[model samples]
Target: MIPDPDEQVLVDVRAPLREMIFPFLETIVITGVLWIVIGWFDAADAGRYGVGPLRLPPEWRNGFVYLWVMLVLWRFVLPLLRKRRRRMVVTDRRIIFRADGFRARPRTLAMSAVTWAEKERGLLAVYLQDSDLPVYYSGLPKIRKIARMINDPLI
Candidate 1:
């Protein structure tokens, strides 16, 4: 929906450092596990599969692993870039999830549609809070202020 000419933005919420870092850490862990699995397969007896091990030299294996790790790192990079493009904007009339990218479609929830708003505290809670809709502003600084804006009747 188009904003009214008189509409004003009250808060621009962003993902906190913890929210941003966790995904990178998770990606690293997953990629590490994948690397271990690959190593196991490489070391497995060729007789088990009726096929010989890869004929590439040891240096080639190292180079391939390095390239694989770099590719896996891209998984982490994309999320960070996407998060950078994303923003939660609280305005006088609604809450908006804006992603400044060609493939992203902005989402907005009218304030009146929010049944409740609260500042939930906890490690995972901070990162996982959401309304019924897909739009969320968890792990954002000034969360209390944002909640107040959403819950206030006089806004």
Candidate 2:
């Protein structure tokens, strides 16, 4: 994303792809199970011996197809698109988050409004003096250092 006029960007990053591993694995497991069941049912026609293509009842097949579509779309495709399109930008004057699928406008937090920024687990938590809750910035490497940088302009 282009920085605002008179603004300098310090960090521009998207969430890493590794974050999608679990969902990909889940799709694999679910598909594998469905294939195995269908294959077993297809083997030996009428419980007799013969090699043939796997087939499910029409209703069952349709349902499974819909399930697979939803799984692929929701777990795999959507996240991939989101990861590619979204960005977290820390600028000299403000911190901004943009996700194409999530919002039309980038969420902006002025650095001037931040009272403190701290590292919690692997995320950067920015605390505003007006709000008790901290907004977290995830998927950033060297989160502790980044927190310090955000908290202190001098650094």
Candidate 3:
């Protein structure tokens, strides 16, 4: 039977793929707007410094800027965001995580090994157990079955 020790803890299932959809268009638009504003500021600074003319830097190519932003986003930003997301939580008895995805780890829980479990839902208070842990899916496919087991649980 699915172990329901009156208090079981689970982690967010969607945490592994947080912000999966990269907003290429959005990033471009925002970056473009910011660049324009920066150009204006550069012109003002040049005037203040008595520079010949407010000539933009030769290396400030739009293509280079866009590529730079995309590179940083793909190489640094995305990984950081995913890392900060709640993927797995350590419990007294087991670890909970999504087993799907080409690189995701499988979810595993052991009742005998667990000494405590805690689950907190917004405005719902918290569920804590000292014997078993709940392994429920939140965003994955076929998550309903697991959710049902949690809603009306049994030992």
Maximum-TM-score candidate:
2
Please give, for residues 32-137, the per-residue lDDT of candidate 1 as tens digits. Answer: 7768756655664343443355443566557657766776667677667766665677777777776634377768777766666666662112121344433344
Residue 64 of model 3, lDDT score: 56
Tell me how far the alpha carbon of residue 110 in candidate 3 is from the true structure, in angstroms, after superposition: 1.9
Candidate 1 ranges beyond 4 A from true positions? 1-5, 23-62, 65-69, 98-104, 112-116, 121-139, 153-155
Q: lDDT: which candidate is best?
A: 2
Q: What is the lDDT of residue 97 in candidate 3?
A: 58
Which is the better candidate, 2 or 3, if ranked by lDDT? 2
Error of 3 at 53 (Å): 2.7
Against the reference, the lDDT scores of all candidates come to 0.62, 0.74, 0.47
In model 1, residue pairs whose N, Cα or C atoms come closer than 3 Å (at least 3 residues apart or on different chains), thus clashing, are none
Task: Go through the candidates in order and give the C-alpha RMSD of each one to the true structure.
Answer: 8.5, 4.2, 9.8
- For model 2, name the residue pairs that clash: none
Cα error of candidate 3 at position 114, Å: 7.9
Q: After the best TM-score superposition of candidate 2, give how far the Cα of residue 108 lies from its true spot, in angstroms.
A: 1.0
> What lDDT does candidate 2 reach at residue 116?
91
| Tens-digit lDDT string for candidate 3 (1-155) | 12247546542344424334455455566667767765665665567555547666645555656665776687556665544443443333454554334466555555354333333341111233542434343434224433433343442
Sorted on TM-score, highest at the top, how do the candidates line up?
2, 1, 3
